[model samples]
Target: MAYSEKVIEHYTNPRNVGSFAKGEDNVGTGVVGAPECGDVMKLQLKINPENGVIEDAKFKTFGCGSAIASSSYVTELVKGKHIEEAMTIKNTVIVKELNLPPVKIHCSVLAEDAIKAAITDWKSHQTPASAQEPRKAQES
Candidate 1:
């Protein structure tokens, strides 16, 4: 199957392709595998605890170009975004952004899942008191 230009670019020069040390207080990691294609993806984020913003992101994906592109693009999307804001990212956005074809949709889904999983892992590390605190109200 043919790949989109964005996919090609990402596959050739993926962004943030590395890992953070485990057990870092500010780092969260998510690992997921696609049973259908035997593909695996690991995504990690370094978050700013005080403001809940993602300061950096990294990903390693073993799959087709679509999967690599999806992971790469998502890392970029999550950077500089608040945890809550990053959680809203959907697979459709990845599909659109990478011009992923129908069969490659699962790659985008994997990316979305990775984002949520990482966020969940990060939240799990938060102190109960801090986790329980009410979030700042969003201005309309």
Candidate 2:
């Protein structure tokens, strides 16, 4: 299938296409695969702990042009966004922005899932006291 100009552009020059050092405390890494299509995606994010802003994002995807474009676009989209704001970015938005055809929509979904997985990993790494203190205060 033909790709949209945006997809072609992103695929041609994929952004943030590398990984952080292994065991980097500030970095969160997410890896996901599509068994049916044999696609694998690895996404990494570095976040500012104090304010929860995404400082950097990187992705390596093994799939079609749409998957690569989706991963690249998502990295651009999340950089500088607060974690909560980034979480609000839906797969449908990626699909629309990239002009992905219906058959290629799963690629966008994978991108969204990768983002969430990375964020979850980041959260998991945080100290429980630091991570839960704000929530406890809010509950009070």
Candidate 3:
């Protein structure tokens, strides 16, 4: 099958491709795999607690072009954004931006899950006296 131009661009020149060698020992790691679809994605991130910003991201994906691109895009999206802002990023944004097909929508969900997992992992590392639970979604 032929990949879309966006997928081709990201897979060929993925951004934020490596680990932060000495990133926080508490780096958050999220792994999602869908056997039926033959896709597996692992997203890891290093976040700054003071600012709740993603400092670095690395991913290992096993799947088709859309899956690869979705993971790649999320990595780019989260960097430098406050954790809460990153969490607010919607799959619709990914879908619209990547122009993903209906059949591949789950790929965007996987990217969202990876972001949540990474943030949860970051929260887990906080000292007992300092751990801040992720705030709930506030409806407007």
All models: lDDT?
0.92, 0.90, 0.78
Tens-digit per-residue lDDT, 98-133, candidate 2: 999999999999999999999987887777665644
lDDT of 2 at 106: 90
TM-scores of all predicted structures: 0.90, 0.89, 0.82
TM-score of 3: 0.82
Candidate 1 residues lying further than 4 Å off, grouped into runs, are 128-140
User: Sort by TM-score, best first: what order?
Assistant: 1, 2, 3
The best candidate by lDDT is 1
**Deviation from native of the Cα of residue 10 in model 1, angstroms:** 0.2
* lDDT tens digits, residue span 1-140, model 1: 89999999999999999999866778888999999999999999999999999999999999989999999999999999999999999999999999999999999999999999999878876777645543222111
Identify the superior model by lDDT, candidate 1 or candidate 2. 1
Better-scoring candidate (TM-score), 1 or 2: 1
Cα lDDT of candidate 1 equals: 0.92
What is the lDDT, from 0 to 100, of the residue 98 in candidate 3?
84
Error of 2 at 8 (Å): 0.9
Model 3 RMSD in Å is 6.9
TM for candidate 1 is 0.90
